[model samples]
Target: MCNALAFVEEPTDKHAKSDGYCGRILRAQTQGTRRDGYNEFRLRVEGDPENYQPASIYRVTLYASSPSYFRGFTLIALKEGTEGTRDDHYAGKFQIIDEEDTQFMTNCPPAVTESTPRRRTRIQVFWTAPPSGSGCVILKSVPFKKILILLQQLLHYYHYH
Candidate 1:
């Protein structure tokens, strides 16, 4: 097991979002905590306006909690400029815990990986383009615990019925 310490950080850079058909940029953010337990946080991303060519970028962050401290990390995602091909990047990048300037933990579960580069965790940003949409960012924290919760919910629903 690793020594638990928490801290706060932001994504590598900011991003702009165009029509989802075109691609949206991805960003990362990090924050820290003292207690090691199940937690949930939110990330906000905005799209460009209808008159501005439908393009904008936003940042995303990640956080970790320990018995005594908190840690964080971040990254950037760029829109590829295609129609209906903009994919999520955070859902693949690994969570970085930089202590002594070295990334600590590696890949883990509950986080989805795609045919793209393999990553530890992905900042799941749920949003829709302009003209008609409300954005929602699902920042998945504890993968294992989340999976358990999902399973439990499913089981509860399955047996309770």
Candidate 2:
């Protein structure tokens, strides 16, 4: 389920270099003012193949498993319809596991208005660079397609418990 993944270096913000698309590893070493290799990536759900749009939702999780200093990370889900767009939709934040690592789980970061003629869907995860210049960032893979399934399971578990 962790196949569909895209690694981008600060696509939205101007702090880091913009590494358009380069699979998992955006850069092997940091450089210039971009001393931080931090970045944000989107897990999109364009909908079914046959039908143009199908009812859908997303579940996003951010996990940091590194041995260095990390400021924090934010996850946001934005939606754009035939009419216009949305704002800084804060999904959730990663928990500071220690002085250097953290993890986060969004029960169901706001849903996209499927009936609002929404053409595409995306889960954006943003990360900050480690202060120690350790050049170490570890993140678990998030499957783009199974977002609905994972969200359902999370919701059901939350309600059931």
Q: lDDT: which candidate is best?
A: 1
TM-score of each: 0.24, 0.24
Residue-wise C-alpha lDDT for candidate 1, range 35-149, written one tens digit per residue: 3544433233333222211222222333222321212222222222212233342222333233332232223221322222223233333222222121222233222212343
lDDT, residue 115, candidate 1: 25
Question: Lowest-lDDT window of 10 residues in candidate 2?
Answer: 78-87
In model 1, the runs with Cα more than 4 Å from the true position are: 1-40, 46-121, 124-126, 130-144
The TM-score, computed over Cα atoms with residue i paired to residue i, of candidate 1 is 0.24
On residues 66-107, what C-alpha lDDT tens digit does candidate 2 reach at each position?
Answer: 222122222322111110122232211222323222224332
Which regions in candidate 2 have their CA more than 4 angstroms from the true location?
1-126, 133-135
C-alpha lDDT (0 to 100) for residue 27 of candidate 2: 25
Measured by TM-score, how close is model 2 to the native structure?
A: 0.24
